[model samples]
Target: MTASHNWPPIDPADGWALILTELQRDLERIDPDLVMGQVKQKFGTLSVSAEASDPALADAVHGRIAAAEALSARICERCGQPGRIRQRPDGWYQALCNRHALEAASEMEGES
Candidate 1:
């Protein structure tokens, strides 16, 4: 696994929690009444503002997801060897090596 040398001041393990805290704070400060109205109207929330958007936030989310993927890639769920993220037929997030991905497909089928 490639060590992310460009990681922020926080430890890698703590990055996700810290970023999520900031994300929640940012969202909460954005006027919850408007946010709720938008959600009811559009069935989805708006994207973060450019001004409020932190490069660190993007990097943090990517790094956490990627780390999960990288871990799945390294250890096969079924065969127990180096694995990689493969697309599941059911179209959901399932971290598995090539072989276990298929296994996960059945397990994850019909799951939202």
Candidate 2:
């Protein structure tokens, strides 16, 4: 079984810990696996469900995604460069400058 302690690093300032904890409790009360199955089955199907207007649920989902995006952005602590991480096929992550990123993409295309 995977351990929570081994999970990837998360931003402490995002308030995700509290939100995630509550979500876990809610899932525990019901079957998370079942909920996931339902979601998968209904994928791409949008309906005006009973709880569609739930303000709290909307707020929670919005807050979490915003926090994640914020954490993904990095302002170079050394050079004051603002950038984000992009995944590489080699399994290594790169923090690229705007110019560097475009150049790298061009090089990869040329290689192909």
Candidate 3:
């Protein structure tokens, strides 16, 4: 199969964007005719939908998705930098760089 040009639009500011791009390239290598159906981000996780002619190609795409998801957990949402996932007292979760994480903590403390 040949890779189709139906890749979903992505926000460049998102740290995980690069990972998605790499996945697209890898998918092209695996099957150039593969159809990328949809891509979306929700609750700090990325979802990619793809269709391939063969089971092996589909599995490869799934593997790529898993790797990208793992990488997103360590990338800051606010800035494209190394980070850790943090949860607010209100139960909201975000991945942020150290600087942003500290700032968020300070803000939460001030709310008290």
Candidate 4:
């Protein structure tokens, strides 16, 4: 994905691999010459930046991004199992399943 004008540094996390792969494929179909920018997780959900020439194409690209984000919100950031957004004592948030939530909490406690 990066080779396209050296734009996309697409590094999908363990849980987001499948979602991102489908996203990439959909993006290519929408705009074959699309050049992607930084893809990050914002507010415990997927956030993506992409370049498009036509407004119509851009709108379609945005729709796909939104769809991917929606799907990711229900999945654990560490594993693909169903999850929800959790707030850390420090105010940080993440999408995590019940099993991984314990591990994350332990790590946070260690930091404290």
Candidate 5:
């Protein structure tokens, strides 16, 4: 199975984009008929949901998802640059560059 025709939209330049592309390639190699369901990012983590026609492919799919999530923690969501996981005052986590982090902090201060 190939990536779903309705896979969630992801910016081509985003770091997660590369991860997803690699995932698709790897999954296809393991099981050419594996159906990629929904691919999305939530709370700074990459979630790749898939349905494997064969139960044997389940472990491989889960391994790929785990690796991708680890990589996402080091990629800036806004600029696709290298970053570290940072928590905002409101307890939301994001991987961001210094500039964007400062900007977000300023915006939060303004809101207060």
Candidate 6:
């Protein structure tokens, strides 16, 4: 039997530890042979690319990944608090709580 995998070693600031854990658990049950290829944050939400040999299994895995990504959009990447999407001066978006948003804005402006 193949060993179960853990969450991809991505940044933890996204408050996604729980989400990743839950996703891994469900994935193990739904598609044991499936493997997560890449996990990253894109456009203010979680993005997970998975690999699977079975087409039907792939669909199920993708569905689960979508669900996790959706959940991440509402969670603060810094503090795991409820959050909203905000855009940076660079035009990139991030899911952050009010306090983190303010801090990030200041940091972007070169403030300490």
Output the number of the lDDT-best candidate.
6
Query: In order, what lDDT does every prediction score?
Result: 0.37, 0.36, 0.76, 0.79, 0.75, 0.81
Give the top-scoring candidate (TM-score): 4
Off by over 4 Å in 2: 1-53, 75-112
Residue 19 C-alpha lDDT in model 5: 71
TM-score of each: 0.26, 0.27, 0.72, 0.86, 0.78, 0.85
Better by TM-score, candidate 5 or 1: 5
Ranked by TM-score, top first: 4, 6, 5, 3, 2, 1
TM-score of 3: 0.72
The alpha-carbon RMSD values of the candidates against the true structure, listed in the order shown, are 12.9, 11.1, 3.3, 2.3, 2.2, 2.4
The per-prediction tally of clashing pairs is: 1, 0, 5, 0, 3, 1
* Candidate 4 ranges beyond 4 A from true positions: 1-13
Candidate 2 RMSD computed on C-alpha atoms after optimal superposition onto the true structure = 11.1
lDDT of 3 at 62: 77
lDDT of 4: 0.79
Q: How well is each residue in 1-112 modelled by candidate 3, as lDDT tens digits?
A: 3554677666787677777778888888877878777776556656677888677778887787778777877888777689878786767777778898888888999999
The candidate with the higher TM-score, 4 or 6, is 4
lDDT (Cα, tens digit) per residue for candidate 5, span 17-73:
777677767777776777767777677667677777689888887788788888888
Ranking by lDDT: 6, 4, 3, 5, 1, 2
Model 6 spans with C-alpha error above 4 angstroms: 1-3, 10-14
Which pairs of residues collide in candidate 3? 1-33, 2-32, 2-33, 3-32, 3-33
| Candidate 2 TM-score, C-alpha based | 0.27
Q: Write the per-residue lDDT of candidate 1 for residues 1-112, one digit (tens) a residue.
A: 1112212233334313333334334443442221211101011111222221344455544444334434443444444455544555644343346666665776676464
Candidate closer to the true structure by lDDT (higher is better), 1 or 6: 6
